[model samples]
Target: MPGVKATALSAAILVSAARAEPLKVGGIDLDTPPSHCAPLRDAEVPKAATLGFVSGAMTASAVYWIHREQRRRRQPGKATHPREWAIWTRLDRKKKGYVTRKDLKSLCYRFESDEHAEHLAKQLDPWGMDHINFSSFINNFKVVQMMRQAGRLKLWHRCCGLGVAGNVAGHMAQAGEAGQESHSATKPAAIFSYYMPPHPYQVSDQQADKKRLQEFPVTYAVIDYPKLPGACKVQVEPELGLLVDIVYTKDRKRVDHLVPRRVAAFNDCSIRSLEGAEKLSMKKNWGFGSKGISLRSFPVDGFGPGTFVDFLALVSYMKRDGEVFQYSVKAPVRNYLLFHEPLLEWIVEQINGQKDTDKWEEIFPQLAASDFPTSSWIALGAGEYTDYGATHFLQPLDEVVVVVYDERVMPDGPGMAQVLEMFEDTPAPAGSVMLHQTFV
Candidate 1:
């Protein structure tokens, strides 16, 4: 009887401990939001054969353990649950820190039919890389979660723009972007304010909002022409913008994850003259209405081949004195040097690794000091400008329009005549996202 009582007491203590600790998968606490999880530590690279064998054994063990635990704690009418991390680990057969299209397809087939799984695989691997690292995996996971959780708009303020990613020959020289040629395409060239919706607390605490407003200022939402100060030349840098969710480390020293949710047309309007500018950001944020993004944006279901993003193309036009002409070269979004998943991966690296040297400023430290915003609107890169766009600075009443549209709607690309028709048409062309701004 004493032995039985002792056993009962031990069981009670074990149950108490289990209840106290949160469920964890792959050393990550599931109870905590994914955004708050600590950055994944570097793991030792395992030899191929050994990695395959060990990973296979570990995956099998984990599956069995999870199922056994679930059955023991099962409640009536409850469905069996498997964590996302578990699925990722199982698919990473070689434990190579990434998963291939084949792995994704195989797993997807379980819930989706074979045809659907194949389609999903294509959507997941839009860049045709055939494999995706953990960052991309988590990004896709978060995208799904966002789609499911509707109503609340993700809060974001800053817009990070990438320079030289245009890869258009001689564009830097033409734009007179000094030191831009030396900067790597993978890194962000400048940061500007895009959105700063007043917080409820700001109603009572006006000073807090004022301080932030003074720093970032209002650079986006250009409805009218931008007021150019002094003898400055302004030009539109037509680019694709991605609205993404940013997840930083608990300490906020580093970016832990990025979830790209939407794609839109962006104008990284810039001052032609450097004048007193020492850094790229100095020329970027001139004041209110200095930059622009299309009011209409398309949701990014996935980054891969058959997804919504894959069909998109970018083109810009300028209307001056009642005449419309192509401003930036008509190019598909896929034409950028770094795009889709690769671009997202590069952004993560730059956010965490880019240093303050020469014309570039350190971004991570700034984000950390600024209360770690949960989201950002990133301008991937500008497209190469046509002769007219490069040579002509905005005169009073000049109209700039940047469009991101589905190329499948016009497979062979549109002619100048068709483009002009689009420019003149009211309510914009179907299947297109447009950002139109006129200079005063």
Candidate 2:
């Protein structure tokens, strides 16, 4: 009470009074009407009277109480409507927090509710606004039937690259040399694992004589070059990631069908110099944002032959010391040995039976533990790295960029020539999934 202001005390009293069944104002009961001796019984001093008649204390108290009530109503948890929260979480992944007309349009398409997209947009952007602050939008509107199911949706990562391209043999050799094992039996492999950030067992202050486990060095969209044991060298593997719908059989409970929903730019970012590591995923999983994927994605239906993704190519760039250089081969998706249905088939097989090797492990047992996740991050391998990107390792302050876009949508021109022309442009073109990760 020593430092408490009179107005603050008055507001606190008013809020306390609000909780009771019969409200009392300044010790005057409202439920029993007014007593003859009540201070405000016959007069409208606080409500209708001007400054001349009302005491300064009373006026200030009224103003403070109203302000406090409005503030309380606007608090985040209570204020954010359920439907708005649903739309926010859905958009949070795709839009990365900001919502615009274009974003809403895409969301509508994803949810198959385009008819209500404009209406919802109007609610968030009444005056035809541009980007709606995610918080403001969620606090204002409620959407029906748009709630995604509640569950701890595990994010599964599927790394691809058996023998497609990008110097598969060369990588295998490097892996074998690091692990001191023969490379002859090495085959294409995939890992079905989710990222786990640093746990109590993973981190410690006292440096051990052996090797220290690397932790996830970042939290947001940016990737960090983690300091690891055994002369570590980190590199970015530019790959295309897919979000799929899994179909499971009742009796088997295994993933029977894989339907790719969306495709986006992904950096299957990894560690290159691991000494005698048993599993490939050991070098892969460091923590949250250890890998980079674009929040924006293109539907997969139009991505097959003669489709959008068929004409699309994956490109990568690395920026160092104000200079940007091509980091990986701009390869077309169709060029990949296995793609579309075939790629899906290969992934399922790899999950079920691919044998483990020194360089990589099949992780079938791991998948089984997670109940064979239907949804996963399918990384379809990185393209050929540039001579410089291949040799040079990632360092702090370095920027890695990966983009996926359609060449068919480009201005009419020759086949591969148009793609080359498109890649030569300084910045990534529109309608492209450009994932940017700043290492540090």
lDDT of 2 by residue, 1-440 (tens): 63666676567567767775565556756567555655564567656466655676788899999999999788553134432443354455543557677777766654455676777677767788677875666555444233111001112222211212222334434433333232232433454443422222333564232222223222213575655567378888777777776566676545576677788888877777677666666666665446776656788674355656677677777777767777776677666655666667767776666677654555455444434444565677666677787787887666667878776654321233333332232224566767666665
Q: In candidate 1, what are the lDDT values of residues 7-109, reduced to their tens digit?
A: 7767765765778966554455555777755654345334656788999999999999999999767632102221234334445656687788887766544
Which regions of candidate 2 are displaced past 4 Å?
1-220, 302-304, 410-428
Provide the TM-score for each candidate, comma-separated: 0.56, 0.53
| Candidate 2: worst-modelled 10 consecutive residues by lDDT | 147-156
Query: Quick one: RMSD of model 1?
Result: 27.1
Question: lDDT (CA) for every model shown?
Answer: 0.62, 0.57
